[model samples]
Target: MGSDALSPEVAARERTLDDLRRRMASVPGRGESATGHIPREQPLRRDLLPVPGPLAELLPDGGLPKGAVVAYSGAHSMLSGLLAAVTGDGGHAAVVGLPRLGLLAAAEMGAQLSRLAVIADPGPDPAEVAAVLLDGLDLVVLGLGDLAVPPARCRVLAARARNRGATLVVAGGTWTNPSLRLDTRVTGYRGLGAGRGRLRSVCLDVRVSAKAGPPRHGRIDLCAQAGRTEWLAREAETREVVDLREAVS
Candidate 1:
């Protein structure tokens, strides 16, 4: 059937895909070689996207690797921080199937809302929507919910992200063989004491495991105040002094 005869929703999806393609075409040197082929080995900068400073320390490359699929599990704030960092760095990003994502929090974290796209409902097949977005966006975040995507489909999406020089982040699903996996949890909170002060910051414990290396762990503080957000690294543990004389006596 012709596009003109399609339903309004379908036509709108088609239009969005077309617009993404056009935008990608206008950009230059997205890991493309002189022969118009995407090179496997992109330069250092082009091979990765900027991430928040605290999160960067957990990754091997100090950034989110381009052309790779990463699985994130844990606090949703981590994802928000990622969106903020990527968009704030002048890169385009899209979130699929996450209607509750706090764009206001992302903005406070320094995200460029104009460069970010949110597809609250991707009409059942969110992976497909994410694939189309990968063609143009610098980062594509897909929320998988309880659906267990087949390994084959995941591979295809990974390859597409690689060819397009985009990063794919899968959240809340069973995706096999991602390049990296990050697990995070809330460790503590700060700025509230004596039942009087307002909440200001949260501490998260982040665990990063990649394909080739041992897992790395770190703590980070997500601070929001005065219409701005900041990610700050925290010491993994605090030291306490011990006196041996008391025990021995």
Candidate 2:
């Protein structure tokens, strides 16, 4: 009875994947979907230049959303670098009001000069910059500081991106309107050297909270080189669904 509820959607996705497998089966480095394994198609081509960051490669889609705002933490430099790489590839990207961001470091990660715009103005208005950035670019990167705007505007940007197939990466706080909210956790870190060494490297654990579909969560491992990102699937773990309406007591 429980499996019956999921038959239609699961069957449809399976059929689609089976068809895709048949077409791409001859391709190298690609493997077949094992028994009981759910097939999920990666959004972007995995071969495009990898971004600089340890966790960029581990993301399920191989990168961030091409048209949705993803709120994140300021502590993870690797995460920010990954976002910049996504925006700076083949399209113009705007980094708004993130004064603390090291543009040089981002560039070192993989941000392209011709496709990057860094807006350092610390103004009270977010809509102004958001409007301009949204209109003239394929991607928008904003640092959500202590802003006083309503969530509706964020929703509007999300809707626009979804409609236009553009991607937005929002850092520094919780974005309620995201199609997927990515929460990162550090699994392990390496050492470059002593005293002057950088964050040797780190792994990322992701918890994706979605607005509609079933919330997906998992962990991934990644390593950052001078300007390349490598992602590896660690373990695809299932999450427990708690009913919000149910009483805790």
Residue range 218-237, candidate 2, lDDT tens digits: 55544467666455556436
Error of 2 at 119 (Å): 0.6
Each model's TM-score? Answer: 0.81, 0.58
- Specify the poorest-scoring 10-residue window by lDDT in model 2: 240-249
Q: Per-residue lDDT for 186-234 in model 1, tens only?
A: 7666645545356577778899999998999998888787889888888
Regions of candidate 2 where Cα sits further than 4 Å from its true position: 1-63, 192-199, 212-214, 218-249
Best candidate per TM-score, number? 1
What would the C-alpha RMSD of candidate 1 be, to one decimal place?
7.8
